[model samples]
Target: MLNEMRALTVSELTHQIKQQLEGTFFHCVVEGEISNIAFPASGHVYFSLKDSGASLRVVAWRTQAGKFRELLRQGEKVEIRGSITLYAPRGEYQLVANQVSPQGVGALYAAFEKLKNQLRLEGLFEPFHKKTIPAHPRKIGIITSQSAAALQDVLKTLRLHRPDIETVLYPSLVQGADAPASIVNALNIANTRAEVDVILLVRGGGSIEDLWAFNDEAVARAIFASTIPIISGIGHETDTTIADYVADLRAETPTMAAKLSAVSQDELRQALDLFEMRMTGVVREKVTKYRRYLHRLSLRLQAQQPAHFLKESRQTLGYLSEKLEHLMLKRLSCYQQQLTNYEARLNPRHLVGQQAMLLQQLSGLESRMADAVKRKQTQEEQRFEALVGRLNNLNPLAVLSRGYSAVKSGDQLISSVALVNQGDELTIVLSDGEVIARAETIIPHENSPHNKGI
Candidate 1:
């Protein structure tokens, strides 16, 4: 029976150990530095609790995770109240933490707070010192690890929001002892390049110790001194660093930083659509108004037509002709009356000489009267012809027929180049048709002759 000591499957053995450990350490306490913390979407928390000597795996269920997340940070000393248990799948023992309390702030966090306070006193974080982020950045400079998941997140978000936006990446270390220097060097390079509209200093979420480089004094100073607006996104939403405080804007995550840096293409496209609609409405309104005005003008022109004036002139001429005829008839009647009186007074001997002289004088008077009437009629006809010539010369249509054109901006005549600008739309009225044209260039005359006379 001793030699046949039973062989157990690995899974069975693991299960037994798990049961034994759970029974023995039904409750226990763990103190160590938290590291490699992860909070999954399921709301459970998984992390490593490490000391100088060794490390232990820890897991907190969703119920415990929610209560301790705010208090637990990477590299932070914490006391965990939980039970020891073996995980059969991994064949490892882990602490199932049900309660967690901070032992103290980590050294890196202490330094971060100290520098933040010092910078606050120095006014580095003052609103007045911060640069405003452009609403529509042309280019964004991202400073982070080339292979960082944070960079990928930022890139994906930016592409979704604004596919046309250009992004330039400055790769740098985001963790470890040399990370601070690398970040500072990257900042310097971005400043020297000076090509981006804004800078995004971002990194994936990590424990306090892993994100310590962002809390470095030199990196903070570099951010504070940057001319370009900086948006800092380091670690989780609950995590804060010195760089976050000094940056012009703070984003809880790299994805948020990408959004804050640029306006979405859809938003811009919608704005343009609205503007186009408004402009079209304005142009239509103007066209309607001008059409009404033109109609009124046509009516006025018809009312003052030369054909109507000519008709009135013809009526006046007819009235003058009647008056002339009446005057001539009256003169002839008077002559006849005088002739009759002379006949009544005639003697046989005196009548012969008197009749001959009177006949000659009568003929002369008649001839002079006819000549005066003919001259007056000729003068009237000549004056009418002159008036018709002047009217024809003043006709707008006549001018257009001479290869001259009239240009109008809206309904107003464009009399001078000063009234128009490059790219202005104009309606050119020609002899037979109209042409719509856009001004391509405007050349202002220097010491213009028109200005000189004025």
Candidate 2:
């Protein structure tokens, strides 16, 4: 039977198809690699899941995406469990994922865990095993794909930071199956040459599979054992590989690694200029201080010289000597005036004439005075001569010479008869002769009745 076709709106047709697909698909699990991941500020994740030739769009809202946010990354293999839904407004179909897990990890994760544990026991990730990055590298060797943007970025950054840095590039495969061996050989070559101060293993951002070479055990071990300090700058900011753990420094990008290994020339020049200015200021200050000190010392020296004082003292002595000489000359002139006045007061000629006249008058008076003095002298001379004649007549020697005999007893003369006694020795002197006589009887003076004198 021919039935009339019912008319339906475009919205109705789309709604009906969405409902039917939602009912038929239900919630299911799909495992594939992630591609074209896009995150917007709306807190929603948008990406595609793909196998060999097919891809399905996915949309995980913020509430459901929280669990898988850290685990989801570009090119990572994951299994997602979600409900199939069709957006009516956009007329597009997509999976609204509710949960996610790493693919093949049910069995592989156990083995990974077991190996990680075993390695932990062996101290493969010990901090003591980590090497130190050089502060100022003289030469930097780069291990990267020859055509990569990472190599160009690293070279540009090093030239900007330090133009004097020497850099060499060792080309290698950064992706695919052969990348790990290429990187390991590059590291070995860099170590053997000893020409580079530091080694940088770098590549641009890519999917996890593209960056897998850096996670290889051989590459990680080679990085750890490198003599030169190694810096890993692989993938994007969110990617972390096993090489990151072993490298001496892990930079987010190749440019950042170059900046970390070198210094800026402009900053160094500014510092040197400041230092030179400070040294000049210090030297100038010292010279000024010494100059002022020398000036003060010179003035002090001038004040202390003995020549000025000696000259002043000599001038003073000369003034005093002149004053003494003038005083002596004045006294001599006064003495000369006094001598002239005394000479005028005592005229020698006048005094001598007056003495001559007085001498004539005195001569006339001397005739009378001399006559009186002569008469007095004549009488005194006569008296003196008469006294002499009397003295001569009274002389005992003269009497003895006159033949008058003087009787004496020893040296004494007998003056009275009474002095004579009976039996006394007598000394008699007759003229020039002396005799000693002895008294025979007492004698008396004849003036009395006794006749002793007879």
Candidate 3:
């Protein structure tokens, strides 16, 4: 006996088959090298996963693609977690992948480590080779994609910390095969200008392949060769590259880099206020001491009046004259007695001996007195020369001869930006000449591009 046959449309058959495959293979894993990768405007990623034995069509829709787009590339081995499904229109079977990750020993990753070790042996990663990031900088340079999220992060941070800090952007391709060359060129441009105090090399977080440009040998060597200091903020906190090792400083993210490069103006203003207070206190103390000294000097001068000193001197001279007249009369009587005794016993030999002895004593005393006076004069001369030498050392003009200049506003020295304004006249005193100029700008050290944003 024969049964009645029921014919079905292609649409109906395809739909039924799709349901069966989806139901039976609810979940599966595919490990293979990726090929024929295509990312259309729709945001869905289509690629072929191939092995030595066979190939399978795979699709990662927009949602899953977005999660790991930076991790995908052609020829890389990857493990796809997905469910098998049938495409009714094409009459083909494909895998709809929900997750993707690099398979064992990702080729790009192996190369990265190999190169890293090679460079390490060559001492490229040594700490001594790294330059010091300036504590204060006049300008900042940035190297990144103009439209990259990393650039925006850094700029936003800079605005928050120090808007006055000047920044120069060197745009470049931060991903793809040609990204290495673009980054190298940007580095070169920054070095040529040499205007910025430090350069920030930054990019958003990505997989090994996306961030490979920073791992290039050329880029690493260029960073090493740069005379200006460089800060690397290439990826997420967990992500590190060769550039990070070569840079003067490493920041976990672009925003962190900007914060590291500038200081808060409010904090600096507070510090300046404290310094002014201290200086005022010191000056007041000095003024008080000087006033006291002048008061004491005035009292001393009043007590030493010339008229009082003259009257005292005249009275003392009259008394001394009267006493001298009495002493001279007494001495004359004693001398007459001594002379009569000497004449009774006197001889020529004895008189000659006494005269010679007195002359010898006088000569010795004179020589000793002359020697003491000569020594005192030499000591005073030596002390005067030493004082003159010290005075010269403290002279501002002497300092100018050693390549230092002093800026003065009127007669006052200009030590800080707070003391001057735009268009103010200034005198710059150098060793050999003076320059009359106008203050065109006032740049505070704390507001410089390379200060800690305290």
Best by TM-score: 1
Error of 2 at 180 (Å): 1.8
Q: What is the lDDT of residue 142 in candidate 3?
A: 94
Quick one: ranking by lDDT, best first? 1, 3, 2
lDDT of 3: 0.88
Residue pairs with backbone atoms closer than 3 Å in model 3 (clashes): 262-453, 263-453
lDDT of 1 by residue, 1-454 (tens): 9788989899888888888889999999788999999988998889999999999999999976875687668888898889998877778899999878666434445677788889899998889888999988889999999999999999999989988889999999999999999999999999999999999999987667778898888999999889989999898787788899999999999999998998788889999999999999999999999999999999999978999889989999999999999999999999999999887778687888879999999999999999999999999999999999999899877899999999999999998887887799999999899999999976657775434222
Name the best candidate (by lDDT): 1
User: Looking at candidate 3, what is the lDDT of residue 246?
Assistant: 82
TM-scores, all models, native as reference: 0.53, 0.48, 0.49
lDDT tens string, model 2, 226-309?
999888898767666777777888898888877777557776788789999999999999999999999999998887779977
List per-prediction Cα lDDT, in the order shown: 0.89, 0.84, 0.88
RMSD of 2: 31.3
lDDT of the structure predicted as candidate 1: 0.89
On a 0 to 100 scale, what is the lDDT of residue 310 in model 1? 93
